[model samples]
Target: MTTYRDAGVDIDRANEFVEYIKEKVKGSFSQELVTEFGGFASGIEVKGYREPVIFSSTDGVGTKLKVAQELGVHDTVGIDLVAMNVNDVLTTGADPLFFLDYIAVGKIELETLKKVINGIIEGCKMGEVFLAGGETAEMPGFYPEGVYDLAGFCVGICEKGDVITGKEISPGDILVGIRSSGFHSNGFSLIRKVLKDSGVKLTDKIEEFGKSVGEVLLTPTRIYTREVKRLKSQVKVKGLAHITGGGIPENLIRVLPRDVRAVVEKERIPENPVFPWIQQLGGVEEREMFRTFNMGVGMIAVVSEADKERALEILGKDSFLCGYIEKGERSVKVI
Candidate 1:
């Protein structure tokens, strides 16, 4: 008689895998999480907001996963998954409450999955969000052996009146640019193509960068939750933008009002070695580079001239006054 295991799906192994991850999932829980891991659905309690506005975002680490798979590194990608979603919700001045993850793998590797889960838990701690629950699917034949993909969903809450939608953004508002750790999980499609065409290996290290290609590429995306939350409480932040796939120009424009433009002073953007290296490797142009990568700036906050000092004070030295809003049609210009 044929059994399910013969068809590449192992019910017994899947059950054991779930049991294995239960404790790892529990490590991320807090008082807000209302249900255990094996429940029908995860539950969270929303409190402390007089008029709560729920903010949710779902995102996945894109082709960047290829780097992790190639290097046999699974942990940091989970942090990238959480950062992609939680940082997006944080754009609206919300405090992330909980996060859920989805992992799909060709085969269930307990140690590998555990490393990924541990990274997710670490990311949850960084963002101060509870790891409410997640799903892991062992789909053989659909994906190549030893390959997996990760996606995450994050939910946050904010008072209705405290949402930073950029509606209040006006001309002369200062644009504060926060430095990115590295590539931050975007623009990897081009990165891989360039590296492959140039015959660059993951272990190859350029003297300027002082690290292997894999090390720089696998760096976890930074979580801006704490810095942003603190800045909002201390300053009048008229608008906020999370720079991701579209880079500075595309992402920053999303939060600009119709009548104002963001005039970014490119020189003021802190130098990150990765962008210069990528440009040299790919022979990419200045505008295309800015259009495709963060180019150093990851998060942008617009504050009035009066509050710029306090905003910078709260954001600390990792940030700088990179630009200013100008009276123009709705757009962003890098000059």
Candidate 2:
């Protein structure tokens, strides 16, 4: 007789994986999370606002996952998974509430899977959000035994009146750039192609990076929620931009009003060593570099010229005056 396990789906093993996930991620549960584990869905009670609007964002780790698989490092990408979604919700001045993840693989490896779960728990704790629930699917023929795909979903809360839609961004507003932790989960397709053709091994160390290429590449994306909360409380922020797959030119322009453009002074932003090392190694064009990677500016906040000093003071050492808004159709200039 054939069973579900015979059809490339292991019912018993999948059950075990779920219980393991429950025990591992309980640390991220909060008083606000009202649902128990092993449920069809999760719940969070809305509170702390007289008028609340919900914000939801979902994202994957992109090709950066290839680096993690190559390096046999599963944990950091879990953090990157949460960072990508929460930071996007944060751009709207929302308070991240809870997170869920989806993992798909050809077969389940308990040891490898646990590391990824622990990493997700760490990410939820770092953002002060709850691990509501998640799904792990094992399809024997769909993927190879060791390969897996990860994606995350996040929901955030904000007052309806407080949503920042970039409608307020005006000429002369200052663009304050928050420093990136590294290459915060982007441009890895190009990075991989370059690394592969250049005969560079993941274990090979680039002297300036002070770590193996794999370690540097596997560096998890930064979570900006903590920094953003403080900035919003002190400054009358007109707009916020989370620099993601599109780099500064594409992501920054999303928050600009129809009648304004952003002028970013590239030199004003601090540099990360990984970018230049790859540039020379890949022989990639200057314009393409800005179009792909964060180039070290992770998030950009638009504040009035009057509040520029105060905003910079609030952001402290990690921030820089990158540029200003000018009167024009929506666009971005990275000079």
Candidate 3:
């Protein structure tokens, strides 16, 4: 009989892969995660909060995965998967409780898949989320050999009234931005396109960044979970924005109250050598650069004027009071 394996699908191997992944996934479980891996559904107990608010975010690593494929590095992309989702949930003052990943591949090699899962575990640990469960699809014809795609779903929780949705954003609210460790998984399509057009190989090293293009591009997405989780307890975060595909203005505006605007000082953005180097090499315009890249500021917190000093003191060197809010159209003016 011509069975399922004839269609490039190995049911036995898929089950074996699940067992392999389940053991690794179990390492991230905590008391909050009630469901074990390999279950039809995952469950979390929401016992503590007065009115628990569940926050969820889903995202992928974007084109930065190309760098990983080129360099044969599979580990860090798993962290990128977790970061993209959990970081978004953190913006809402929620504590990430658990994460689920979706990895689709052509053919599953045990070693490469292990590295990916290991990185995911590391990321969940960093973000304080339990690796509850996930789905893996192995379709040989759909994907190229050794090529895979990753995405994840992260669910977090906070007290109902405690969610920081930027409704309180007003004039004089300080814009405290946290520094990014480089590109942080956004805008890689542009980066790759620019490099390819310039005939600049990923291995090429220039004077500016002091690292090869691939090295800069492959820097894993930062998990600001620890910092933001701490701040959730001590500070009143009126607004939070994760700098992603739309860059500052677009993402920041999502949390800004209507009739308010953020005035960012361009000079205050951290001295990120990678951006200027890429700009010069690609001859990208200043405005285009800001709209496309993080420009060194990855995450931002908008807080009340009274808490500005306290926030600065608590945040220490990781935060920058990049600007203040003003009464105007909902806009961001980088002066």
Report lDDT (CA) for all predictions.
0.89, 0.89, 0.85
> Scored by Cα lDDT, where does model 1 land?
0.89
Which scores greater on lDDT, model 2 or model 3? 2
Which of 1 and 3 is ahead in TM-score? Answer: 1
Q: Where is model 2 poorest over a 10-residue stretch in terms of lDDT? A: 27-36
Candidate 3 global lDDT: 0.85
Q: How well does each candidate superpose onto the true structure, as a TM-score?
A: 0.97, 0.97, 0.95
* Count of clashing pairs, candidate 3: 0
In model 2, where do residues sit more than 4 Å from their true spots? none
Give the lowest summed-lDDT range of ten residues in model 1: 27-36
- Please provide, for model 3 over 166-193, each residue's C-alpha lDDT reduced to its tens digit, 9 standing for 90 to 100: 9989998899898888888988888888
Per-residue lDDT tens digits for candidate 2, residues 76-183, read 999999999999999998999989999999988878888898889889888778888899988888888789999999999999988988999999899999999888
Provide the lDDT at 327 for model 2. Answer: 95
**Which portions of model 3 miss their true places by more than 4 Å?**
206-210
Best-to-worst lDDT order? 2, 1, 3
CA lDDT of 188 in candidate 3?
89
